[model samples]
Target: MVIGDGILTPCISDSIVWISAAILVGLFMVQRFGAGKVGYTFAPILCIWFLFISGIGVYNFIKYDPTVLKALNPKYIIDYFKRNSLDAWISLGGVILATTGAEALFADLGHFSVWSIQISMCCVVYPSITIAYIGQASFLRKNNDLVGDTFYKSIPGPVYWPMFVVSVLAAIIASQSLISDFLHNPTIPLSRVLPLCEIVHTSPKYAGQVYVPEVNYILMLACLGVTLGFRTTAKIGNAFGIAVVFVMSITSCLLVLIMIMVWKSSLLYIIGYVVVIGFVELIYLSSVLYKFKEGGYLPLAFATILMAIMLLWNYVYKRKYYYELNNKISPERLKEIATNEKICRIPGLAMFYSELVQGIPPIFEHYVKNVPAMHSVLIFVSKKSLPISSIPVEERFLFRRIDTDGVNVYRCVARYGYRDARSEEEPFEKILIERLKDFIREDLAVNEGERLEAVAREIEVLDQACFSGVVYLIGESEVVAKQGSNLVKKIVIDQAYNFMKKNLRQSNMMLDIPHARMLKVGMIYEL
Candidate 1:
């Protein structure tokens, strides 16, 4: 709107809305290609933007009242606060916009080195922003009538068109950065927070650079809605101010917790941190909350709805996990079932995927009780994610032989880190087979005398049998409301959890197992 109004007449400014919408849609559509391809293109443009703003700021500051620099003095801030009090505090909400993108520094830490980001900010961004704001203030002091369009009006006549172009480009780039952060960061797994969608990782070098088509379109549609509904920058800025202050307050609170728990800081340090950061953020948060009736309510409304969904998901998941832990069969029970001659044995290898590491899942027992048959080679597989970024390939899988019967029963645990890519390029069956082969070779090398011979013989038979085929088994379990449960539990488990389970990506698809060889055993839990 500023760019269109600045360069063109009022007639052309109306068309700028549709133009902005089209550009936003185009930016989101190109996200599937990944950030690595597009991130570099923005760097030079951003540099130019900073330099231009700083240069204009310096020029304007020198031409107008150089005395305006006196506003930087601490006494002026103190005097203004003392004089206006509540009004001054309320205006601080507008002041937060000056530091809008500062949070991105911490967010982009995953993409760039700390030292590099610090150097860039210290040398270019901070100085540029400081001078640019001072220059805007100086320009406004002289030309009070042009306060609404100060940025465009301050530009020199000769370079107006070029400056307008740069402003529009910079605005689009800024919007793109925020949209990408919303889609990728907060570290929430798409399967848990959203419905099933293909999440494409664009950069192999940076696991954080992901593109979700569903999220991208959703964001685009939302941007269009806000743009059309508000039809003015002032209303949008009001909502934007609420969102910025809310995020800042939340970030400060999280940092305080991290300092106490992760850094193990002293009480003195905690008090100082809270007094410095918390005081400022709380003031801003309170100011924004006061404006809740005037467009500020939009962000709080959205956040409340989202928080309810996440809380319900957490509750249901915990209940289901507790139920599974209590119902899991003991290892002795599994051995007894394995040794039973009454159970007919089938010919192929069967891998049952379950959540428990130490015991047999109820789903497996249910499958066997109904069919009255077990596979020649039984393997229970569990894939667990650790808190770290990536696990070493050598330490990825752990295998242990369970029962000594002619039909071999084994347990395999595959460990992965949170950021580790579970590439679908290699099938799960193939990886498991290779890991098992490695385990056999290692066991043969380590064991002495009679044990070595036994291991070799077992490996030979296992190799031949595995060559036949493999079957992947997983449970399709659902949680139902148990008798005497409260209303909240019933609503959370029977309704919310069931709805999410039905909509989310299935377990077999997530594991990348082939549909033809996969068996999904349906089961119900009265929890």
Candidate 2:
């Protein structure tokens, strides 16, 4: 209804849907190149866009009716509400569309400073948008018949083509901003072998730059479906309006809590903010929801499905964590492994991956019970993310040696910051081995003759094992709900969660974890 149709381009016929679908596919295809590069390319075009809109706005305002500025007073708001009553309230559904991408400006703040966004919003965005709308209203007064194409139709013919090109770019950028934030919620489960940090990390220079292929393609499909389904900007705008006001409403509530708990602001100030901003957003939300059947339900439906999955996953995640913690191998089990006559010691190094931070995971017990063999040089690797931005290189690996009667068993806890970018398997393995050697050099280089001899022997064994090659034993856990569990628990764990696990089998190739060199130890946990 906008670009390929007469609203923006008159000659393109009814192919706006396909044109939109093409642009959307292109956007998703390029996301893997990282947002930093994409934004850098788009930034200058955006600058040109604001200038174009502002210039056109001023031109129309002056030529058509400069006197329309008189309607800017607050009294008109009161007068209009009084004259139209409920009709005026219903108009908010359309009016809210003006503020559609406002929240995305806040979401992308991590990529830019507060001052830059503030200056841009205040100096450029605010004034340009105000003037453009006013100019559009002025143009409407003179050319009322062209209300639908008021934006494109009002442009002076000489610059109309350039403005059309700018408008298309602007539209995509607007959607891209919101889609960046949309990719985070209810993220699909990733493979145990694939680190969380690698899923979206795309840029080498910027820690925040991310492009999750799973989420990006899913969003692209959704956008294309909406384009084909809605087939018109009017219906799509209805959905857009609801999403904007709904986010604003939620932001308002979150602000109050943040003010009270985080900021420790005054109650009076909170009340004032709520009364002013909260009441207005509430009105917009109520009015927009009236169009629920007319495409307003898209956001609601999307949100509902995501929320359901998140809830189910959260329940199952907690259950699985407790099960692991409760059934972890005891310290005595480590000593028994070395003493047992039937337990065979293998040649190469074995790296067992688990969720446990301290104790050995039960998967080892399950493995040993079945095979009756263990590796000569054992290293338990637990890679987990901590609640921070980035961890120092020196502090990343926490090493602890287990005194298990010459079993040469050690525990390595690899800590990562939530925002840290974990690269390929080779780098990860290289770093861990270096850090392990460093640990031995620092802790085991004692003055005792026996201790020194033991340290030398241990290093020799490690070298021999590494030369023989290494195997990664990652646990493939299956969580089944206990018979005594409730209906929801059973449904969530055995049905919804299990189904997601099965289908969410991402290729370990992305992480460079060679499937041939890795062995998955299967374990069933009834939680």
Question: Who wins the lDDT comparison?
Answer: 2
Prediction 2 global C-alpha lDDT: 0.75
Tell me the spans in candidate 2 whose CA falls farther than 4 Å from its real position: 1-15, 184-198, 385-396, 415-431, 506-511
In model 1, pairs of residues that clash are none
Question: Model 2 Cα RMSD, Å?
Answer: 4.4
User: Per-residue lDDT for 104-171 in model 2, tens only?
Assistant: 65566646678988998999999999999999989999999997778889899999999988888887
TM-score of each: 0.88, 0.90
What's the TM for model 2?
0.90
Q: How does each model score on lDDT? A: 0.74, 0.75
lDDT, candidate 1, 1-527, per-residue tens: 11111111111122367786777668778777777677788888988899899999998898886789899899999999999999998888778767876755555665667998899989998999999889889998999999877888888788788878887778777776665566554465544554456666666566677787766676667677666676666555566677777676767788888988999999999999899988888888787666667766666666776678777777766667778888887777887787788889777888889877887788877887888888888888998765466777768889988754555888999987655666667455667777887887776565488777877787776776687778888887878989999998888888887887787566776666778988988788887
lDDT value, candidate 1, whole model:
0.74
Candidate 1 global TM-score: 0.88
**Candidate 2, clashing residue pairs?**
none
Residue-pair clashes per candidate: 0, 0
Best candidate (score: TM-score): 2
